[model samples]
Target: MEEWERWERRVQTAAHPVAYRLMRAVAARGPAVRVPRVGVVVSDAGLARQVLTDTEAYTKTGPGAAAALWSPVLGSRVLITLEGAEHAALRRRLGGLFTQGHVAGVCERVLRAPLGGLERRLAAGEEVDLVGVVRDGAAEVIRELVGLPAGGSDFTEAAAVVSSVRLWRRSLTGRQLHRARAALARLSEAAVESYRSGDESTVPGRLRALGLDEAEARGAVGLFLLTGTETLVSFVPRLVALAHDTGRGPDEITDALVEEALRVTSPTPVMLRSAARAGRIGGVRVEAGERVVIVTLLCTGAYGPFSPERDPSETAGLRRLWFGAGPHFCLGMPLAMAETRAVADALRGFPDLAIAGRRPARGVLIPAYARLSLRAAR
Candidate 1:
C-alpha cells in the first residue's frame, strides 16, 4: 500500500470498521451529505464549523448523540441538553476553572504524584500500559475536580467502562448494555459524596451555587465523572504514539505538539446537533429538527497528519473546531490539554519510546486502542 493509504488505514482501525466506511463515503461526496445518519451529515471542516458555531441554527437538544444517550443516563435539562442563553449561562459560570493559566497550574499539582510514579516506572525500563497509566492519572484529576473520594482505583476503572458507552450503544445489544450498566453502577457513591459536601472549589458546590438542588447536582456530577475521565484516557496515550513517530523526545513538549495531537485525535470526533431553524451547510439546506453530525476527525482531515512543528497559519481553524466552535465547545478541553502535556512531559524520561505492539481494534465507541503497550528503545 502507498504511504498515505497505509496511514488512512490506521484511522479506520480507531473506530468500528463500518463507521470508518460511512465517514469515508460521506467525505468523498464533499463537506456535507444528507442521507439520514441521525439527520443531515457534514464532514467538511469549513462546513462543520458553521454548524457548530451557529447555535441558533443547530441546537444539541433534539435526539442528537449526547441528548439521546446522556439524557437516559443523566436525566433531562442536564447541561448537555440545554440550548441558547441557559447553555451559555452555565458554561460562563464555570468558565473560570478552565482558563489556561489556572488549568496548567492546578494540573501540575493534582497530577504530580501519579505522573511522577509513571515517569519512575518508565525510567526503570518497565513496559508501561499507557492506557492504564492515562486512566489512573486522568481519573484522579477529574476525581479531584468533581469531588469524588480519594484512594481506590474503582473510579478510574468504572469511568473507563462508562465513557465508552457513548460510542457503541447505538449498535449494542441488551447483554452489552446490562454489563455496562453494572460497571457504571459503581459511580453512585462518589456522586453522592460530592453533591452532599464536596469542596466549593469543585463542580458540585459550583452547581449548587447556580441553583441545582442536591438530587439534580448529584446526577450532573455523575454525568461529568463518567464522561470526562474516559475521553482523556482515549486521546492522551495516542499523543504519546504520535510524539514517538514525530521524533519528539521525552524532555521535549511544545505547544505545537499539544495542538497537533488534539487535531489528530480530534477527541470528540462526532458531535450531533439538531437544527433549531433552517440552515445551509456547504450548499446543503437543512430544515428545522433535522440533525447535523460533525465528523471532527475526517472534517479536520485527521488534522492533516501529526506534525511535531506545525505552523500557526496552516492550522488556522484547528483549535475552534477540535475543541468545538462556540457555546457548546467542550468544557473539559483545558483539563484534557493539561493531562496531555503532563503525559508528554513524562514521556521525556524515556529516550526511545514506541508502542510494544498493536491489537486488532476492540470495536470501541470512540476511536481508541484496546490497549496501547509501550517500551523504551534499549
Candidate 2:
C-alpha cells in the first residue's frame, strides 16, 4: 500500500477497528451483501445512489434508519430525521443559510483570525497541530451558526454523544439515550434562549423568523452541532496529509484535488437507510425494516487509489457521492467546501508545509487525526 493509504487505514481502524474490518470483508463479497446482523451492505456507487434516491422503497424515517438513531435526542422535526413533504419544507426554509455567498461570508468572518494565526505560526517555522487548528475553526463557525456564546456549549460533549453510536445498532441504548439527550440539552440551551428572543441576528432567531417553531429551531441547532463540526474536523487535516504524502504541494491542491481527496477519504464513511418495503437492490432481495448500510468508503474506493493526475471523468460516476445524493444531499456542502477552501488557501501560502507527526483518534464515529503536527519542511 502507498504511505498515504496506509496512514488513512490507520485512521479508520483506530476509530473503528472491528467495524472497518467487517465493512471491508462485506465489500469483498460483492456489490451488495446481506449480512446476518448488519442487514444489506451496498458497496457499489450506482446501487448506493439508487437506494438513496428511491425514497419510495428506502427512507430515513423507516425502522432502523437515521430517524430511529437520532430523532430521540434531536427531536422528531430535525431535517435529517424527517421525510417526504416535511423534510423538503424544512430544507427549503433553512436553505438560505447555506447559499454560497452566505456560507462564504460565515467562513470569512469566523475563520480569518484562526487561519491567519495558522499562517503566522507556520511562517515562523513553528510546528503546529493542524487538527487542533481545524477543530478550533470549526467550533467557532458552528458557534456562530448555532447562536451560542463563545463558551456556550462544549463541542466535545456533542462529539461524545456521537462516539457512543455503534455501527450495527439501530438505536442508542437506554443509557446511551439518556446521555445523548443530556449532552444535547446542554448544548441547545443558548439556542433555545435565542429562539425565544426572536432576534434574527442569530441562527435560531433566523429559524424563528423562517416560521420554524421553537422545537424545530432547537432540533436544528442540535443537528448542526452534530453534523457541522466533526466532518470538517475529520476531513481538512486528511486533505493536507494526502497532499503532503503524494508530494503535491499546496500549489497543486486545486478544487479537483480537494474533490479527489474527499472521494478517497470518504469523511462520512457510511450512510444508513432502512427498507420501507420489500425491494431488490442490485439483485439482492431486502425485506421491509432491514437496514441498508452504504459503505461509502468502499463504494468510492472501488474507483481506485488517489490520483489527481487522472481525469475528473474517472470520478464523474460518483456525482460527489461522498457528500450524498437525492433530497438528503448534504445541506452543509457549500459551507463545507467554503471551509475547506479557506484552509487550503491559507496552506497554499506555504508550499513547504510538511507533516511532522499525527495520531489517529480512537473510539469515535468519525475517523480523524487527533493530532497532525505540521511544520515548514527543513
Q: Among these predicted structures, which one has the highest TM-score?
A: 2
User: Which residue pairs in model 1 clash with each other?
Assistant: 250-347, 250-348, 251-348
Off by over 4 Å in 1: 1-8, 151-190, 197-203
For each candidate, how many residue pairs have backbone atoms clashing (under 3 Å)?
A: 3, 0
- Could you say which candidate leads in lDDT? 2
lDDT of 2 by residue, 1-378 (tens): 899999999999999999999989888989999998888999999999999999889999888789999989999999989888999999999998889999898899999999999989998889999988998899889889778888644577777778768777788999888987888888888889989999999899999999999999999888988899789989999999999999888767999899999999999999999998898998999999999999999999999999988999988989999999999999999999999999999988888888888999998888999999999764
TM-score of each: 0.86, 0.97
> How displaced is residue 80 in candidate 2, in Å?
1.1
Model 1 per-residue lDDT at 355: 75
